[model samples]
Target: MLRALCALLGLTSAAIAAKFELSPKKFLTLPLGDIKPAGWLHDQLQVQTDGLAGHMHEFYDLVSKSDWIGGDSYYSYLEEAGSYWFNAMVPNGVLMNNSIINEKTQEFLEYVLENQDATGWLGPEVDTEKPRCLWGRYPFFFGAIQMVEYKPELTARVVDALHKFVKLANRMLRNGEGVDKWAATRWEDFVLTLQWLHDFHPRGEEELLVDTMVRLKWSGVPWEEVFSEEYFPTGPVENLTNPFGLELSWHGVNMAEGFKALPATYRFTHNQSDIDAANLSWDLMFKYHGRPSGAYAADEMLAGLEAVRGTELCLVVEAMFSGSYLYQVIGDLKYADRVERMTYNALPATLTANMWGRQYLQQQNQVAAQNMSPNPFPEDGPYSNVFGLEPNYPCCTVNFPQGWPKFITNAFLVTSDKKGLVQLYLGPFEVQTTLNEDNLVKVSVETFYPFGDNLNITITATKSYMHYIRVPSWIVGGSMTVNDGEKTGLVPDEVTGLLSVTIGKGLTKIALHYPAKIVIEERPHGSIAVHRGPLNYAFDIPRSEKIIAQDPREPHAVDLQMGPIGAWEYALDADPATMSFHNEAENDDHYKLPSPIFDSGKPSVSIAVSACSIEWPLAGDMFVTSPPENPECLGDVKTIQLVPFGATKLRISEFPVFAHSEPSLRVGNSYQIGDDSEPVQKPFNPTKPN
Candidate 1:
């Protein structure tokens, strides 16, 4: 009788059923207009659309041609690229600031939805003999999933279309048609969409589809084993040890996207080994190919840890997405730390300050942003750094726009229980959400965060609730204050770096103050990377742009070159604690108003330090490479300006340490000097001197 009553009311028997624990999406993303970008954030979004990501269609035949979707074209990937613009770039623009792209976005979305074939394949049906690539399907899927959140009216249509398409894809996979090429290589992307659909619409067979797709993607070797194999990064892509060599983990983009594969599968299997493997894979990647910019080297392949080796723009955005997913699935704060580093440093360094130009590959020690015959990339062309609409490749053109928009979207996240809220990442933004279905909570976060360590949060709530603020792992000895209450030391989670606090009803103001100090990190060679908070410091190399070529039709596809305007070879002469920071906002109130810092195209913060010229040498083509071994100082010590690594177009990030005669300033294995200024507590250990 009890079982019959429970069945009648639609309650499941917890014993027999899987309990449907809210899939991968227990927390919801705010609508496009809910957490709008403010200050510099708004300006950057506008510039993005006004520039290449928005205007590529005007000049490129792939984006503008009607045949891209309906007619047979050799370059089928362009069709997916078009879908990216419609699915993400356009909607993101309007959502960001109600830009002029709204009307066109509406028109494009309506056309795609209304014109869907009865068979449910939304893309063009052409060239059945062609390899039936499955990877191209995912970009559209990502766009459609995002649409389900942005436009609620389109949900039913999108869901039906995705369901029918997944069934068709599953059929193709069973017949051995779509299991061959790029689809097989980057199966993680396809698998993630399956997981998403199953969780969103759990209408019985969705689970079967997800499981089938996961199996197809897994082939014979489990993803955990694939990630755990230790033979990586020894040679070229052909030398990989796994079966189906040169297919999956060797590619940088695949490696990044693969970071989430094990975690995604863990959802269904509940395997602890998957989690452990995911952590191990990250360590291996960093150990082999990590760059100072918090990304792995992949100049179209697994490049090694030379500071000059470049990372693709596609990898930057994909890695951030992977990090975001890992944080959501694993609830790890270290993932957030990685995301912050990549978003602030690697993502912006590839684009021009105005967002009008971008590079296909960005190098950490880049001295000249121009094409060279013998480029550092194994497969990239000479025009990699020309910073046109698409320099060496156009994949970045279609994919890169998603980086900032999604980063902003993920700025504020709710707790798994939906009772508390957490700031997953920080920038200039506001978050408004309801807690417990009755108490409304709104938070306004204002600060030039990475540029400044102080953050002021104003909370207006209808009732009391718990708020979790993430303290970055880099921060030490920070303090938090609430409504003029006792200033409390931030007791951060040693592992996750989160600080939790409770708030009462009405409006309350909280201030977070963390001291910003520079710490030197020893790099691969005998060089050091200077860091403060989350920003990496680089020598302030001046740059002048030279236009190489331009498309007569489109204004955005102009090949431009950047050459350094100042000398870049300098060694650290004084301690990091003596490094001084200067920004005009310190005196100007108008500039201090909270906004994202880069949109203005003017980096406000500058680090001043005493440095002496060094005898560093350059590689072929005059490009700066690894700093030379501890060489004699060439010039008298001079005070030079260093800017944030992300702010400069051409810079030398790592520098050799200078030897000094001072006794108290001795480091781990070598001697150095410090000016009269106090020294930071945990300075980098000096590398062993030759």
Candidate 2:
């Protein structure tokens, strides 16, 4: 393959002399478009906006005007909710650009600017006037740094405030001041803020700020003391923890928050001290925090060392956003890899399938919640989990926006030589770097990712620049061709490889090979699971809604294939039609039955899918699943297609051992499942003792 200059998307060398400018933001022209994953974020934003419509303006007014203690708790709730929307939106959301929801952000900005003191502090209810003022600027900076299209002046204001706060805080700390005797821990926040100031200001006041932050020394707080782990983070929490005893002090995701801010410490000032401090903390965090979902743990109470506790909604959103930030600054595929896993498995697992809502917390085993709230809320908000506004806590209520759609920022970033680089592999369209240098390069990349084999990169070359594309570390025997002339084959490895293309000089035609791959990794103790791309599929289960009428034999175990995706094709083994449905009596412990207490201790088996929808008349449809035949003993059920654990609405991810190995039932080719030959059965009783 020789070097040849080809036309860039139909543009010739003569007209390709567009001036390229450097962007202070990650990718220069990111003003227009929505976030990534596209499944939940788009709908959630639209619905969340609608949900806030009735109280949106009022909510902003409440935050701006409410006095801390003189008013009712509603004001505090309003402040909390406003804080959530403010946090979730700016970095990424419907208001990142010129949208209706942006008005709320403007209102917040107005409030901040109007309330600034002569000393440059802007916070409410301050007793000692600590550096708490810095917390308010995150919203502004998050927006100004990302959206190059809107609010440039606002961005400058954000930068100005950042410097002001850092300088003021340095003086305060020097004079021995800043939030005396606080219940919650908020140490690295100062580290992060100083880092941000360092990064934002080109003139290099970051050194002094970083030094000041390092001296603050609030890093050693124990895990249990914090008032809210959701806001005032403490301790090391990870998914890879052993669930045995009263291990209250271990949490990986909680620790990962600190790790997340580590690299940011370095990127701000390019200094080794800040970087080293961050790395030492991050290295320890990753050791305890890494999880099976490709994320570090922190579901709820820190289940340390192994995934004792499950993941929480707040951790999921935060972990994903943190991973995205990690990807952008460090350029590590592993971070992006973790982000994709959390996005697909842990993330979707947190929310309901219809996008109406998500859970406050999620457990891997998720034993039947002796008393779970089915319709937790009155259905006021789209994903509103609480009775109306606030749920288990304000964490997920405000943090949900960061989970799905905000992934767009993590999709693409610029390389050292002014080229485009793809971070995570899950995708649909080809993403261009839009920047020739720092400014808009006026380019669009065209390709369908994650769906099929080929990916095309068509760049409208403004000038000859270096373009680097990530060849996914997961792709097996992947091959790529440039301009349909030169072709190169790639070897699969644990890490990604860069494929470089020079624009205008033979960058016209493009094709990249995505090998269909299956990943098999051994679990900690025993057993192995398989993954295809980002999806980890398990054995196909047969379902039936008819069984809801009958009783379930057992609840602890479930029937699934020996492996993740069934290796052999057996059609008749599982039937969705045999599932049943029944209303359990209030306080009725055992699987609710129409008749008297059963001799056997078991649950009535209804299709898991039906378990989610039957609770609501909102689901209007007749063909839920087909009915079972004489299923009194086997548990009567109506049948329908049952998605694997990963796909089901109310699913069990980690099932017990007995169900995995079905001695009587085995999959075979040409055998149709859900037919009369093979009966599909599962235990659903939530240990309701008669």
- Which 10 residues in a row give candidate 2 its minimum summed lDDT? 681-690
Cα-based lDDT for every prediction: 0.68, 0.40
Cα lDDT tens digits, model 2, 1-690, are 000111311223332122211112332223424223232233334444444221334443333334322123322422244544555555444433435456655665566555556676644444332334233344344544443334565666666765665667666665665533221133454555555455445355644654454444332233222222232323332333423232332333344444454454344334444434443443444444444445444545454323224456766776676666655655545556556666756665554333334455554423222123332122112222211123355445455665544565556556544455443445543343345454333334443233234566565555566565665544445677877576787533233344566657323656777653333332322222234444433323222211111113222111111111211111111222222222233233332222111111111221221111121111111111111212122222222322223343333332112112232322221111133352221111001100
Candidate 2's displacement at residue 454, Å, is: 3.9
Give the runs in model 1 whose Cα sits over 4 Å from its true position: 1-28, 65-79, 219-223, 234-244, 593-601, 660-690
- Report the C-alpha lDDT of model 1 over 300-336, residue by residue, as the tens digit: 8777777887889889998888888877777676678
- Backbone clashes in model 1: 0
Alpha-carbon RMSD, candidate 2: 15.8
